[model samples]
Target: MTSTDSTRSRWIRLLILAVVAVALAHALDGVAWRSARLLSVNDKDWGRLLRSMGYLPTWGVIALGFWLQQRDHPQRSRYAWALLLGPALSGGVAEVLKLLIRRLRPNPDVFEYAFRPFADGPLSNRGMGMPSSHTLVAFAGAAVLAQLYPRARWLWYTLAAGCAATRVLAMGHFLSDTVVAAVLGVAVSTLYWLRWVEPLPAP
Candidate 1:
């Protein structure tokens, strides 16, 4: 197939997968949430600790540490480009979507369908749950770290999945929220990597 055809095919597959994921999440959101809650009934503290790993600031700190360690290495520039910018762009896009959708969190009183599209004031804790920012950052960083450290890709993905799970376990977001974020995080970060980070001249 031609390059154009190959790209089109890839996009088509992504669209199909996204549709399927949304449908599945819609069908099993409550079931998945309850399962997570049950599994973490006695370990919510662990869930909270894992959840912090997904925070955007935590990602920034990680990238900073990586940069510090690799600064003298030859791939320093490339690592910096991918590690720093990938998660930032992923989290930024997720934030925009959150503000646009304004979906509610899975907190005690709120239901999943609660939304306030384009509301004026700042988003309260109860809202802005769609395409979770934490999951986005976690997965985005994982994608970059996996590429940079190919041998430990599984480790990176496992941590990212753990971070995503914490959201549901802690009732911070629905399963659908983390599911969508993981998809978007990997997609956006991969695209960013290809478009910008991948083209840097090797040192």
Candidate 2:
């Protein structure tokens, strides 16, 4: 890490951060401008089906992955922990931000999505839709898995893309919400890898 190398790295990091910020802003704008017209009129059921596919099921997937990894690669159990943490922490952050922001979902009268919580019968709960927690968790989990198994990067990324698309199709989340979720997921996973997972001893 010479002075020149350090400066270059800093510039690259800053450039990436700026790009992420712009992408997030664009996504948020899309969410704010979302409308029912985005759904297809010809086949509503198909849209709904596509949306349903995006559901991440964070806990079950993480637990299952951990269990399988422990059984198959006991020496690499630490990687499983790292994999699990990405979704867990990202979801936690999304949930807390949701509470604080109190943005409403597309369907205020009902909760149809996987991440939808029980309505507390309050006005504050009416507009609670900013960042898509499901999308964030889905991408986070995907990214962690991809990092752990570089050979399967395409598969993990495909899953993440499906999750993001489903969020919009299901009408459970706006495009912006899913977009921000994706960004957050990637950011969290990247930070974890650079700071922790990458530094671990090889198996």
Candidate 3:
């Protein structure tokens, strides 16, 4: 490999490591913060907003927008597909992990640890909080899209972080869960890019 290519690879690896470090720090901070009773009025309101944002309807709209944008940009269709796959795969993996882990949601009364969201009976799922699926899927989608469109990468990342924060504010997951999910999502997306997405043609 050329020296320039080697340097580029080193830079990419460093960036990925930096991202992972940040995610871990955030997760640790979140867990410690949540464990305390230090929530302020503003924090409560923000939590509520985040929780509401975590709802499917809001995410559905975002997905629809992405779909439409992809349809309009034929040249970027492949990247779009890869972007979609990230979330799909992440969600699938989360489901399997959920079943295997059998962890309960924060709200034991409202949500049982079941395969379906609307399962009957008292919510039995109450204690298996390891990885936040919402955060994972959100990051997966965001990472792929951001990689494809570097110009507006911040927007995508902001949205993903908001979604992840919502999961924590909603008390749907622990801080560690969201942190791990973000890392996993980005890792998977980066792997896909390296394996499949062709880099820009040499100048």
Best by TM-score: 1
Stretch of 10 with least lDDT, candidate 2: 108-117
Candidate 2 lDDT over residue span 72-180, tens digit each: 7665666776667777788877877776656566663453322334455332434565678777777777777777677998888777767666656556666667777
Q: Tell me the tens digit of each residue's lDDT in model 3 across 1-203.
A: 99999979997896788577666755574443355322342257655544333243444565566667667656555565565666777766666666566545554234323333435323333345556777777777778767767788888777777767766555666565677677777767777766776563211
Number of clashing residue pairs, candidate 3: 7
Clashing pairs in 2: 27-176, 103-127, 103-128, 103-129, 104-127, 104-128, 104-129
Q: What is candidate 1's lDDT per residue for 1-203, written digit by digit as tens?
A: 99999999999999899889878987898787656564462266766666765777776777788778778885666677677678888888888888777887876544457776455555543467898888998889889887777789999888888888877777878989988998888888888877877766543
Worst 10 residues of 1 by lDDT: 117-126
Q: How do the predictions measure up, each by TM-score?
A: 0.82, 0.66, 0.62
What's the lDDT of the predicted structure labeled candidate 2? 0.65
lDDT of each: 0.78, 0.65, 0.61
Cα RMSD to the true fold for all candidates? 3.1, 6.2, 6.8
Candidate achieving higher TM-score, 1 or 3: 1
